[model samples]
Target: MTDKASPGYADIAAHYRRLIEDGSLRPGDSLPPMSQVKEEFGVSITTVNRAYRLLKDEGVTTPRPGAGTVVSERLQVASTGAARLARIARTGEKYAPGETSVDHIAHLRSCHDPQVAEILGIEVGDEVIVRRRVFVRDGKPAVAAFSMIHSRALADVPELLQPQPFDRFWQEIYTERTGHVTTKSPERRTARLASSDELALLSVQAPENAAVPVLVLVNVFHDDQGPLEVWEDVYAPGLWQVEGEKP
Candidate 1:
């Protein structure tokens, strides 16, 4: 049993969180292993696991595929929808907070998922183009977005097939390429537990006997012709929102 005065998981998690925030620990920095941390803190491995899990949940640290858990390369920042749109309008880039992305991915794939097809206003089993991107802030995986475009759109905007970030927001690219201006983008929000693949992608783990929940934001872009694309953004858990104080 841990001594009554011994440090707990929160203490450990906070210690690392502060270090990462203060630049004492830089991005891609490895955190001490459970065994080492257990010895230093005089706690069991379980305690260390809990602490690490907490840090992951908060996006302070992330699990690298071949490497162990390390300080996240980005941190998530939450802003109003209007604010996000304004940023995208002024800067052609989305995510990276304006930094060059090292992991932007775009690909063409067929869609058999009915949910995705309905959102795109197409029949089930229709083929679509998928663009996958992981948005990082401060150094953590903030959001993973999958943009599904109908194959027909590619005849006009072939740039969507490129495996990288576009010079401008994709919607703008669509308009300039096909003159199909985006009239509205309606979004739906939901939450669900992360899957095994998601856990790895987000670089976070769930607590013992429980799974991490992700906020799913699905946006369907539409123009005069009809639905253009469906963007599904999966947000990591424990995202922080900035609030303005009343005078």
Candidate 2:
């Protein structure tokens, strides 16, 4: 373990990296016990320590006096951006559920985007139900997303308008409406500097990394009939992991 970036150490570090990226290992989530990880990876404690040290140096995970190694509270988006958001969308995901609350919900009828109209198989300007909400973490805006549901596709499933967890409830509605499992989807994420309007919307207060930038993500869930929903999300700087897996 003389070299912290040795092959074994890198391999171990990479494993944990994937878990964090996929949103499977969320912020403040503890890494497995050293003994457990050693047995699983068939590596010595020195190698594990080296790997853990590397993660800490990169600011992906942190070493706590009593908590061992925990994932960083500052969001770590996977370089493969859309997958992370898709993971959350499919599972109603949250990093710190106790501290995360959805609020400022605005439901409106509009056909705002031509791309959305095409995806939902509606004529441009056809009405759609747009649900906009903000996810606040520690009383600050972390994520803001707009869920545009095709009015025709959402036909009869008014439950989406309620306050329940959207993932499971939406699945139930999908099965009830189409008599089949919900369709799979594709997602894309683009990183950019946070604009004034976005900054105001996020209402950022003392960001962890002032240099960190924002990311715009487009997620679409569709089937034969049309897209069930189209999501455009804005992830505030220092609060999301949009940087790719390379470094």
Clashes of each: 8, 3
* lDDT, candidate 1, 19-87, per-residue tens: 554346778889988898898889889989999998787666799977789987765433323334554
Scored by CA lDDT, what does every candidate get?
Answer: 0.69, 0.66
Question: Considering only N, C-alpha and C atoms within 3 Å, which residue pairs clash in candidate 1?
Answer: 73-139, 74-137, 74-138, 74-139, 74-140, 75-137, 75-138, 75-139
Error of 2 at 186 (Å): 3.1
Candidate closest to the true structure, highest lDDT: 1
Model 2 TM-score relative to the real fold: 0.66
| Predicted structure 2: lDDT | 0.66
What is the lDDT for 129 in model 2? 75
lDDT of 2 by residue, 138-189 (tens): 4677677677887865566776665444654365567776675555465677
Q: How many clashes (backbone atoms < 3 Å, residues ≥3 apart in a chain or on different chains) does model 1 have?
A: 8
Name the lDDT of candidate 1: 0.69
